[model samples]
Target: MSRYSLIRSMFRPARTTPHRCRRDIIMPFPVGRMELIVYAAVVTGLIFAAYHTTLMDYLAYQRDYIAFTTAWPSKPADFKFDMNVFLEHKRNLMEYANLEKSLMQNGTALHELKVAKLYKPLFTDIPKILLDKWVPDIERFEGVEEFLNATNFNGTIAEEFFYLEAPFFQFEHHRMAIMFPTEIKGLLMTIKIGDCYFWSTCHHTELELRDGDMHVLDVLETEDGQWNISRVYYVPAHELLKVRF
Candidate 1:
């Protein structure tokens, strides 16, 4: 061989051995059976905790929302006002009246009046017959007590006279106001205040009325689970004839 040919043969690379096929070789299990079981247990415990906590809370909230939406008194037929509900509302009114009386005696009439939800509505709706020849300057007074005092009337006299006559009075007219259980019926109407269910009833009193014939009571449940008088509509017996319903 020539020197160049010999040199080339010597420098030439040797043939590489064929690589083993890794595809055919089996690998050890990535995770043991015990490790897999532990992982599964942890995942299940997390799921159960989530269901009991977050999911339960969500479900409870949904139930409350449904209850609020599906409350009673959607219509006249759906409405109901039994003696129990009426008595509860009456009791609340009496308590409110007593509070008012106590506040007036303490000269905290303005504070009591500020908390009154019915003052504006009642004063605004005072019948023409109840007022004297001149319209009373009610605007100057801060509260019902102030208004009564300004009009030269004491709390007791005002409660007996104006309050009893006023259609929107908070308290029951009589201490033992006779409620006819048989005649008591619930009548639902469009709520003027807002979107909520309320029990309404219009019934003639067994006790004789000095002026009005019947009393219309609207009772609503407060947020604190107490029933209160939402509205009172005193209508004269003669006026009932003019009223379509």
Candidate 2:
């Protein structure tokens, strides 16, 4: 063939090289933008979820370095747990009297003063069930015998560690008041003050708003829906201990 014919034939469009549909898996020449976005999102979400789960598991087991923390059940059936449950459990854990120890031991950087608490609601360890069953007369009676009975009298833990404040006041309009008989008196006690308070009862652990600076008069709950005073003292905000009214 002449050079012109050869040049013309070469210039002629050859059959489009069959586009291998699966060859470019990493950066596929996508058919649609929507599909591409969806694929990317799914990949990203999966990666993030895996990393987050690993982080949470490590926190739960190796250290309780989380602000709100709990260990989930192993079995799927028992894992009916969710984010809300975890939040509540964690918040509850934060209310321990010895949580300072846990915080120190965990060493997860949350121990520092710069910890940021976002979107947190005000929750008090206002024991309803545990107190009622354990000591029904704590709030009803007007004497030291009732107060002593309320705190279990063993005094292993002091009155100050037993009570907490919400730390941040809200529109709930609930004044810092102690609802008890007028007969509480002559009780000299130390109070703890801070943002978080640690509480412990027979078995359960919880976080509270007890930095310090309150006498006992702390209410507690029993496992069987009983409410009683874990300790009797006075807080600065509420001084209901006057013998009169």
The global C-alpha lDDT for each of the candidates, from Candidate 1 onward, is 0.38, 0.35
- Top-TM-score candidate index: 2
Candidate 2, residues 149-218: lDDT per residue as tens digits?
Answer: 4445323222221221212222237654333331111121211112111232222222232332122333
**Model 2 lDDT on a 0 to 1 scale:** 0.35
Model 1 agreement with the true structure over 1-245: per-residue lDDT tens digits: 99999999998998887654552365333356897798788889999998899988999999987865565345433323254544454456555555544554575434333333112333323343322111111222123443335334332322232232232223255332222212112222223223333332221112122222222333343343433232223222222223222
Q: Model 1: clashing residue pairs?
A: none
Candidate 2 segments whose C-alpha is farther than 4 A from its true place:
1-34, 37-43, 50-54, 57-62, 65-147, 150-198, 201-217, 228-245
